[model samples]
Target chain A: MRASSRTPLTTRLWAFGVWSVVIFFVLNLLGLIGSVVTSSFATRWLGTWFPAGFTWKWYFAAWDEFQLGDVLWVTFEVVGWVVVISGLLGVPAAYALARREFPGKRFVVLLLLLPLLVPSVTYGIPLATVLYKVGFGGSLVGVILANLVPTVPFVVLVMIPFIEQIDPRIESAARVFGANTFKVFVYVLVPILMPGVLAALLLVLVRTIAMFELTFLVAGPGSQTLVVALYYAVFAAGVRAVQSIDAMAVVYMVTTLIWLIIALRFVNPTQIVARAKRDTSH
Target chain B: MTDRGPTLTQRLRARGLDGVTLLVLPCVLAIIALFIYPFLYGLWLSFQPKDGTTMGNYDRFFREPFLYKTIWTTLKISIPVTILNLLLAVPIAFRVRLMKHQRLLTTILVLPITLGTVLVAEGMLFYFGPQGWFSRTVMALGLMDHAPSITHGYWGVFLSLLITGFPFTFLLTLSYVTGIEPALEQAAATLGAGPAARFREIFLPLLLPGLAITFCLSFVQAYSVLPSAILVGDPANTTRVISIAAYQAAFEDYDYSLASAIAMIMGAVQLVVVAAILGARTLVYRGPVAAAKG
Candidate 1:
C-alpha cells in the first residue's frame, strides 16, 4: 500500500503468505506461555490480562520462604545421573542392535521396544517394592533406576535407526589394514555416532528434567524434582488463593522454555534416522 | 594398530569370536529384568493375598468400587483427547505439504512433543492460571467475568492433555502424509475428483494405517498421563487416573500386592482396547495387507 499506487498484489501476498500462519500461532502460543510468568508475581490481579503490577515476593517466597533450592538440586541430581547412566548404557546397546545380528535378532529388537507399549505404572509399583527390599526405597537412586523404564527405552529407540547406519565394512576394512577394535570405534564409530548421540542425549536430558510421576512416587521429600515441587506448591499451598504464586509458575515456564529452545536448536531428529548406514546408495 | 603376541590357538579363537553373541548379552538381560520380569512380578503379585496365597488382589481390584471408578476416569480422559488430537493432526499434516516454510513450521509444531507431560502441565499453569494470559484475555473479552480456572480440575487436565498430545498425532501423520506420492493426487485430479474427493478416496485410504498407529500412540500417551492429571485434575471429580492409584496403593498404603493387582488391571484394560481396535481396524480396512510394506 505504501510503495506505489499500483503495487503488485501477487508480491504483496507472497511476502505475507507464509508468515500469516506462523505469526498467528507464534503470537498466541507465546502469549499463553508468557501469561504464566507475568501472572506469577502480580501485586494484584489488576490488568485485564497481565498482573496490575509486579512483585518479587513470590520469588523470595519460593526461593527462601519455601526453600525450594534443595528440592531443585535433588531433581537435577536424579536427572543428571539418569542422563549419564542411560547414555552410557543406551548408545552401545543401540550400536549392537543396529549393526550386529545373530539368533533371536528380531525378537530381541521387539523386546527392546516392549517397554514403550507397557505402561510405566505396570512396572512402577513392583519396582518400588523391590527397591524397598533392596534398601533403595524412597531414595533418589531408586527414583533414577525406576525412571529408566521410560528413559532407556526412549534413548534406545531414538538411537536404533541412528546406530544402524554405521557401516561395519569400514571398521572391517580398517581392521583388515591393521586398525584395532578400540581405534576403529574411536576414529570411525565415534565421529559417526556423535549426532545421534547428541540428539539422544538432549532428548534424554529434556525427558529426565520433566520427569514427575516416577520421581514423585519413588523419591523422598528431599529428592523431589521441580515438577513434584511445583505440584506440591499448588496442591499443598493452594496457588489459586495467592497472588505472588504466579511468579513461581513463571519460573517453571521460563526454565522449560529455555531448555526446550536449546534442545531444539542443537538436537536434530533426522540425525536419529539418518544415522542408519549413511545413505551410501545415494 | 598395536601388536599383541598370542599363541596359534589364541589367534584362531579371536577370529571365531567375531560372530559371538557377547554384545547383546547384557542389554537383553537388562530388558528382561526391568521389563519382562516386572510384568511377571505383577502377575505373580496380582494373585497373592494379604494373608494367603491366592488371587485376592485381582478379585479386590475388580470388586472395589473406587478402583472401578479410577479405570472409568482414565478412559474418559484418554478417549476425548485421542479424538480431538486426531482431528487437529489430520488437517495440519494435510496443510504441511502445501506450505513453503515447512521446516520452520514443522519444527515449531513438532518441538512441543519433547517437553513431555510435566512441562505441558507447568506450561499450562502460566497459560491457564488465573493470572495467565488466556484466562485474562478471555475474561477481558467478556468471554467470562473472571479468570476461568482451567488447570486445577478436570477440565484443566483435559486441556493440558490436548496441548501435549496434539504434536504426537501430528508428527506421525505428517510422516505418513509425506510418504504419499504426488502422482496419486495428479491422477485423482485428472479423473475429475475435487480436492476433498481426492483426499477422501486416495489420501485417506493410504493414511488410515499411519493414522491408526498415531491414534494408538497418542491414546497410550494420554492413558498413561499421570503428572498432568495429578496437577490439574480435581480429586473431588474423581479424576485420579490409574497411574496415581498405583502410586497410592504402593507408596501411601504400603500395599505392594494390591498395587501390582491394580497395575495388572490397567495393563489388561490396555490390551483389551488394543485388541478391539486392531480387530475393528483390520476388519474395516483390510489394513495389514496394504501397510505391511511400511
Candidate 2:
C-alpha cells in the first residue's frame, strides 16, 4: 500500500459504510415515493423524471365512490378498542409482573410473549369456527378481542422495561403515609409509568391501524379495513376502478408517521424492567 | 387514633391473592384456550378424518405434485425473502446504532408498520405496475421498446415483499442491534482488531440471541403472509404459498378437514422452523467461548 494512501482503512470504511447507507435510503425514498406520487397524478403515465401531466380525477372519483370517510371512522373504532383494551389489561399486568415476587413469573412472562409466534393463518380457520359457535363470529367486538391477542403482548413487552425504573420505595412511602393499594397505584406508580404507558399506547394504536392480516382473516367483508379495502379495489376491479384506495393509503401512511413521531419522543425505550432483582430493605 | 398498616404476612397474603389470580389468569387462559387449544385441535384435525383417522390428506399432499409444490414453493419464497430482509435490515440497523439522529431514521423506517399488508400490496400496484411508475419511467427514458410489465408473478411478489417485509425484519433486528453495547466493539478495536475482526468477534457474538430472534420472527411473519400472496402473486406461476392453498381449500373447496390439515402442516412448519433456529442458536453458543461468555 502506498504510504500516501494511508487515510486509515477505518475512516474509509466508516465513510463507505454509514454515509453510503444514508444515501441509499435517500435514493430509495426518492424513487419509491416519487413513483407513487407521479403515478397518482399522471393523466398519461410516462415520465423521465416527472409525470407528463397532472390530474386529481382519480382522487376525487375515489372519494365520491368508495366512502373513505366511513372507512376512516371504522378504522378509528377498531384502533380505539385495540389501544384501550390492551392498555387497561396490559399495564396492570406489566406492573404486577414488575413488582411481584412470584414462583412462575418467568414462565408467565414467556407465556405472554408466545402468542407472537403463532402465525395469523394458524388461528384463522379455528377462530372462525369457534367464534361462530360462540355467536360473536362477526361482531366488531369479536375483531377487537382477536386483535388484543397481539396488542397486549406488544404493550406488556414495552411496559415491563419502563415500569422497572420506578423505585419501590416511592410506593412503600405512599403506603406508609396512609395510602391504600389502589390509591398508591393511582397516585404514585401511574404517574411515573406515564411515559412508558404512552409509548405502549401509541405502539398498539399505530400497529392496530395497520393490522391487516389478522383482521382480514377474521372479519366479514362489510367490516373491511382500509388495507383490506385497498386490496379488494386493486384485485376485484383492476387498479383503475377504485381510485379511492390511493387516498386511503395516503391517510394510513400519514397516521402511522404521526404515531411513530410520538413514540420517538421517549428516550431509552427498553427500561420498563430487565432483571427483577428485588430490593429487600424496601 | 393512629391506624397501623397490615401485619407483614397479612400484607403479603393480600398482595398474592390480588396480584396472581386477577392479574395473570385472564392472559394465561386466553392464550391456553385460544392459542394452545387451537394448536392441539388443529393437529388432531390434521390427522383425523371427517369420517376417521387417515393419512389420506397427508398422502394427497405428497402424492400430488401441485400440493407438494406448495411446500417447496413456500420455502423458496419465504427463505430468500427472510434472508434478504435480514440482510437489508442489518446494515440499516448498524447505521442506526452508529449515527446521530438514529432515532429519527428508525422512526421513519418503522413508519411502514402503520400500513397493513393490504395497503402495501395496493401501494405496489401503484408503484410497480406496468403503467404505474417504473415501467412508465423506463418507457420515458427510452430504455425499453414497450412498457415493461413487472407485476403479476415472481418479481412482483418479490418486490412487494422487499418493500413490506424489509421493515418488519429491520425493526425486530433494531431492537437487538441497538441493545448491543458499543464499549465491547471499542475494546476490540483498541486491541488491534480491524473493522471486520471487531464485527466477527465482538459485534456478532453479542447479537447472537437478537439475530436468532429476528430470523425466527421474520420467518414466522413471512410464512403467515396472506394478503399480498392473494393480491399480487399470480397463481399460474408467480406464487402459491401454503397459506394460499389452505385458504383456497377451506373457502373455495369447502373441505374443512383438508384445509385444517394444510393449516396444521403449515403451523407445524412454522414452529419447527423457529425451534430449529433456536436450536441452531444454542449450538452456535456452545461452539464458541466468545458467545457463551458474551
Candidate 3:
C-alpha cells in the first residue's frame, strides 16, 4: 500500500511481460497444429506460406488407404466397453470406500494409487506377456482389459470424493423408511450420485480413447485403437503420402479433442488432478 | 408357513461383509488377477534362465553397454524437460492465476493433452521437418542459408516433449498456486511487505514444497517418454529411452526376460527419484493445510 508510486510502473511492466508469454504460447501451439491442418488439405505445400491449393482428396485417400473405417469402429468398441466396465466396477467400490470404514483402508488406497502413479509402460509389457500367453493379447478383449488396469482405478479415485460429498443421513433416512438395501441404493443414492457417475464415466472414456502405452502393447491388427493405428501409419514400413498421414493424425486429434471438451463440461481438469493428489498424500 | 429363517444375503449383511463389501469384491478380484498376477508373472519371467540356472537376462543387460546406456538417455531427456517445464510453468502460472479469464487460458493450455503423444509427434514431423514451415520461415528470415532439419534429431524430440510436457506441468502448478489462499498474500502486503518481500517471506516458503512435488510428478512423466522419442529422434540410439529399449527387446529381439529386466530397472529408477523428492518435501516447514480450501 505504501509503495503506491511504484505500483503503476511495475504493474504496467508485469502486464506486458504476461501477455507476451501468453501470445507466444498460443502462437507456438497454433503453428504446430495449423501446419498439420493446412497440409492435410494441401495439393502441395513446398516452400509456401500457405498451400499451393487445398483439396479434400487427402481425407478420402487416408480413410481408404488406412482402413480407418475398421480402426474407428474398433476404437469405439474398445473405448465403450472400457468405459462401461470401469464404471460398473469402480462406482460401487468408490461407494463402499466412501461410506464405510474398514481395516487396511490405507493399504487399499495405496493399492489404487499404484496403477495411476506409475507409468503404464512399466506394467504394460508384463501385462501384455501374460495376455498373449493366455491367447487374449492380440484381440479386442486384451486391449479392453489392459486399459482397465489404469482406468478403473482412475474412476474409483475420481468418484470417491464425489461419493463422500453426499451426506450419509440421506441414505439413513431412506433406510429408516423401511426401504431395503437395493431400494435405498437405486431410489435414493443413484439420483444424488448421478453427476459424479457421469463425470467419472466421461473422463474414463477420454482416458481410454487416448491411452497409448498399454493399448499399444496389447492391440493387434484387428484390435488397434486410433492412437496405435496412427503410430503404425507414422513408423511402420511404408512410403505413404505425408498429407495422408497428417489426415489420419487430424482425425485422431479431432476425435480426442471432442471428448475432452465434453468431459471438461462435467468437471474441471484441475479438480480431478488436485483431488487425486490429495487422496494419495493422505 | 413359518419359514422365516435369515436368508444368505441377510447373513452376509450381518457380518461387516455386507453389500458394500461385496461391491468392492469385483475391483479387488480384477486388480489381483490382472494387475498383481501379471506383474508377478513378469518378475518371474525376468529371472528365467536361457540355459537352466543363471540370471542371464539381468546379466546380459548389464554386460551390453548399449542396453544400459538407455538409463542415461532417459535421464538426459527427462531432467532437462522437468527443469525447463518448471522454469516456464511457475512464472506463467503466477501470471495466469491473476487473469480474470483463467478458464480460457487453461483451455488453451490443456488442449494439447487431449491430443496424445502419438498425434503430437506426428504433427511435429510435418511442422518441424526440413521442408516444413518452421524451417522455411527461418531460411526466409535469413537466420540460415538453408532449413536445418530439426525434426530428425534431439532438438526436434525435445521440442515435442516441451509441447506435451509444458501443458501438464503448467496445469499442476496452476492448481497448486491457486490453492494457496490469496488472503494470506494480501495480509502480508498490508503489513508493509513489498512485492519481493511478500514473495520471499510468504509465497516462496509455501511454494517450495509444492514445487518439489510438481517436479517429482512431472519428472516421472517425462522419464517415461517413448513414442515421441521413437518417431522424431534418431532411434539408432540418440533418443532411445528405456521404454523403447524394453519394447525392442521384447518384440524385436524376442527376449521377454531381457525386456522385463529393463522395465523393472526403469521402475526402480523412477521410484528412487520419487522417494527422494517425497523425503525432501516432508523436510520443509509446512502449514496444517497446504492446499487452498475449496
Best-to-worst DockQ order: 3, 2, 1
State the lDDT at B71 in candidate 2: 77
* lDDT score, candidate 1, position A214: 67
> Which model is ahead, 2 or 3, in terms of TM-score?
3
User: Can you write out model 2's per-residue Cα lDDT over A138-256, one digit (the tens) per residue?
Assistant: 66766777788787877777777667767789988998999998898789877888877886787677677777766766677556666666666667765454334565456566666
**Number of clashes in model 3?**
0
Give the root-mean-square deviation of each candidate in angstroms: 5.8, 5.0, 3.8
Query: Each prediction's TM-score against the native?
Result: 0.84, 0.86, 0.93
Query: lDDT by residue for model 3 over A154-195, one digit each (tens)?
Result: 888888877887889998999999999899989999999888
- Evaluate every candidate with DockQ and list the scores: 0.39, 0.40, 0.55
Name the regions of candidate 3 deviating beyond 4 angstroms. A1-15, A271-282, B1-17, B290-294
Answer with 2 or 3, whichever has the higher lDDT: 3
Q: Of 1 and 2, which scores higher on TM-score?
A: 2
Candidate 2 has an lDDT of 0.69
User: Cα miss at B149, model 1 (Å)?
Assistant: 6.1
Candidate 1's clash total is 6
**Could you give candidate 1's per-residue lDDT for residues A84-170 as a string of tens digits?**
878877777777677655556778778876777766666677776677778887788788887777777677777887666666688
